[model samples]
Target: MSETVSPPDRAHPGLLGQALALRAAWLGMDRAPAAIAFAASVKGIVLLYVAVFLVFCATRPGPGSMLIVALGLAGCAAMPARRTLVIGLTTLLFIMLRPTRSEDLSDFLRRELDLVGSIDQRILIAGAGIAFLAFGMAALRLQSTFRETAPGRHPVLTMMLVFFAILSVALSGLLPVEFAAEVWLFLAALASGFWCIAYALADQKVKQTTDPLPRAAFFRPFWEGPTLPIGKGAGFLAKFEAKDDTALAVTRLKGLKLIVWGALLAGLDAAARSLLHTEAGLPVLTDAMAAAARGTPLPAALSWASLVVHYLLDILHLAAWGHVVVALIRVAGYGIPRNTVRPLAARSLAEFWNRYYFYFKELLVDFFFYPAFLRWFKKYPRLRVAFATFCAACVGNWLFHFMGRIDILAVNGVLPGLRAFESYLFYCVVLAAGLILSQLRKRRPKPEDGFLRYDVLPRLHVGLFFCLLTIFNEPIDAFTIGERFAFLFSLFGA
Candidate 1:
């Protein structure tokens, strides 16, 4: 017998039908030729700007110094012919305006370099910008020229070795204080733009790569995102650039949608913060940790509540910021993926890591995992996978966080700074083990396993694993590894 299909309204009644209808309307506008044309028109651009401004005001108390630059880049990006030149020039301008991401670097320069009156800070920063650009250009040239050479074949590894060599020398104190300070400043610039340069160099090996200027431009791009290279290098963006007006319009509409969604997430984050920390009178995680360190801990129930709430809020905060950055890139006509996806929905630890911070995970996989996998343990499949996981999740993860705290290494002695990373080091090791097991497991939950087994149990296990791992994910110099263990035990009244 033939079965009869329900009408759309009958299938999804009331509010559900209305939601589906709205989504269908959006999809229709997203594809219709006339709608696309209108979206790419001047009036559409103006509307986008107005909407962005309103969202900015609603989300951010201050729109930040790079807002104007970001908006200008978005406008210029709409004109495909001038996009490359505009991006290159604006990136140079941004570097001149703000040379380094870390404010602590400025303080380090003043105190360690003794540049308080010897030279203007602006001049020094400008000099750093010039050095960075020149170095980036030379690196690109080296990669292109020496593609067959060992250094060119593995630029990321070479760069890391060189960076650490210089860092070691600067910290060795063998050179005069003044000269060492100059070296430290150069190191700061290199560290800030390290991954960008790596991505650019990596792109050079590709058959069709961007020009050196545009490639270098992505080193601290006009969007002023975190040092993680959110959209990656020029080659990655080139693949996603809109080819026609219709595509551009669709991309821009998606961008606007992302911005609005990001703004909503931001608002939700703020509301959650206020509700948990203010309304409910729960202490911040850091404050709670500090209290625990001081031999006074909150009740175990409260501690667990704080931990769970903090984890959710942290995901929301990262997603909000990442969405804004990706949206701006999309507006500029490059349809890159969002930096954070549905991490909470992830059913496995490895999957959670992939969803939680995509760009960072990609960075590790590209720079560390691929290299090790291709080179070592080729005859042993499990060993290869485990080794690659170790390289990426443990070694690369630790190095990335350690590089981010370079200013701390400069301020405190190298030994002290290394000690500060002890807790994070433990975190990385355990994370690698968990990820390795997750990847190696032969069987996975399936539909036949039932809802509780297939859906609920795996997610709950993943959540608890990550939540407990948070104890060791302390900031630089926040707590000792032993103290973090103590706090972890306290959660169970041990």
Candidate 2:
């Protein structure tokens, strides 16, 4: 019997296998009650605070503001029964302490309208307070009276129309300059929180309660980015909120992981910038584009390098900031998805878009794509998809960017502002076309295809497409469409 006995054979795991094993182990902790308890315990909170402080030291999203948010989350955790009230009060305090739009509005008033000291800091604060009150009341009314009903059925479209109407009146020069200036200031306040209010209104349809506190909490919530609703509105937050102590602990642990990951990304971004701009001496993308516009083009190879490096850097920057914001949301006990996923792994244009800037895409789909898809070209399935893609990817994209640059309108008036937006409009059109075709394509890479064709080639094509598309996605308004085209053409030795 001893002679017949043999040891069991075990295969050796390679590097990739080891990595996968580690990832599995990491994920396994999320389901373990002891791990959850540790994450939710006081020790866990203290460790989290230390990690957050270190990360914020590197990234610097205003230490004071971050402290306020941290304390607010602690309060919410301590008073779970009054979480909404805590969130509402916290959001109000955060906005009051760091009013996002007040400084811009104040600067505009002073510089453009020559209203220096006419609208002091106190007035600006008062205006913000009034704007919050008005928008909050409007959200409550919409939720109670018009949830899934007429007029409120398309809250985003309604909001857009009203916004444009006000802007039109302000730009008409029909009213006295002082009144127009006042109107512009009011519009700025509304525009600042426009998307937040729209999200709140949209959530009303699915919500059971018309609570003002939840609506107010979502108005530029402490965890949200400047414009995008990272966790979306109340409906999404409610849906994703931790159901138990264990779940809350897991969510918070995940949040800590994200913050650390984001800090790494921030470091990577800084290192990349140093390598490209300092060590290798690559020109800034905007500056290079401006030089090309002025008939002083960089060498074709250098231009190409600059473009690629800039695109990669932009992705890192976005992903880093988005991760931090989403991490904060998760730390507050909401297990929301990350804002940017692994975009480089995308093998198709639509997939890339979905991964690249998730919340922005969601904003478009919620406000533009679904509405157009449901209401138009119902009989023609393909055309319906194409049209909806156009609405979301082209028209909606254009409008969102336009609204964000309302200050340009104040500075340069309507025509010049529109002219400055030409390049971005072109970018959106090409992007929409690419997305539509990607959606309509029937054949996709399969495993049976060789590894290179099935995996590597598609990713390469997607990467190339997005890289080239960035040629026209210039953020600086100083350059014209012609100049952008010139830079693109010069990349090929034109």
Candidate 3:
């Protein structure tokens, strides 16, 4: 079961790496401060939780929040502190929120499951308490357990543990067992990570010869690694020549990388989906779409396809129109010696997009089918650009149209959404025409002595054209820069 990874051929890996690296570096600095701050942050978060409960009590005199808070403090405090009053308090909060009927499981759980919601939650909290006890009794247990593991400890293993711990902490809200155990475990892990980072950053010497705790904390290994030092020969991009010296290449790298990664991830997702549908009794996205079309209440898992499609359509439409505004604004302010080289370089309908309206393209290419497209482009440069451009528009248009069409079809019982191909071509043509006109309108080399065209012509031409576009196009109308104000020009159109 080997998974394929298809990153773009022209993709640069520097940007994402840089963002993460920067975060890690900052975290690595002043470990002790981070640890203490993390502990303090947890205490504050707890108090905040308590305050929220207190507020709830003030509003409706509910015991649920109070119970939760007391239970939490008990976990943090001790066995003697874990009084029946706290449990009673939690039960009361659940009772307040509980419905009159005892039939609904959710409701029943809220009310009846007050003491320990589930066996799993109880185990989680009880286990944590045991661990805390062990830590207190045998302070060296952690060091011993970590060292004496039969499987043997390694940086990779340490990292895996750290990753799982971090994930637990990060996804605290989504935890299935909303019990005292999970909350405490999450808080403790947060403290651990925060303190570990703080300790690393503190002005303290390394007492032990070496702590291979990275076997337990993932990112720490990368931090401890000698290779990633700052002012070192470009930690990630050291091998890449483009990153070595070129700025333009570096700029395109992120966009290209995203194009590459997005495509691979999408493919992987598709394949995983196929496998799931085949092996398990799982329905695919298409099934979800069909259900949505039929006005059937789709299962939550199935709804993801429609949601993704909706978001994709909305975002791309916005990006495309936003780029158009950028073009118009650039032209509107052309009198100030601005350049139109980007627009001019786009020779045809397709190139116009690669030159203008580029973010989505970058997004698509970097993330969607970068590897496939890069290879396809390299092999057939002429057809590559044209096909890629057309496909990008078509898919984007199709998704957008499908979303709108689905809305109409589901709600109004309409047949056939907008033709993806027609709108795709229309988008291409309009953008191409705009670019061509811009190129054709590129100013003749101004003589030093000639009347400065910078003053009036562009103001009349570019500004008027922009205003007109805003009035006519629905997309443009959505991005109006300024009010007409009875023929007055607006400061910002979009």
Candidate 1 TM-score over all chains jointly: 0.91
Model 1 whole-model lDDT (C-alpha atoms):
0.81
RMSD (Å) of each candidate, 1 decimal: 4.7, 4.0, 25.4
lDDT of 1 by residue, 265-295 (tens): 9989999999989998998877778768878
> Order of candidates by TM-score, top first?
1, 2, 3
* TM-score, predicted candidate 2 vs. hidden true structure: 0.89
- Tell me which of candidates 1 and 3 scores higher on lDDT: 1
- Write the number of the candidate with greater TM-score, choosing between 2 and 3: 2
Please write out the lDDT profile of model 2 over residues 74-179, one tens digit for every residue.
7766775666777777777655544444345446644534542466655665565466557656756775777566666666677778789988988888987767
Best by TM-score: 1
On lDDT, the leading prediction is 1
lDDT of 2 at 269: 97
Question: Backbone clashes in each candidate structure, one number apiece?
Answer: 0, 0, 32
| Alpha-carbon runs more than 4 Å astray in model 3 | 1-361, 367-372, 375-380, 414-416, 419-425, 432-494
Ranked by lDDT, top first: 1, 2, 3
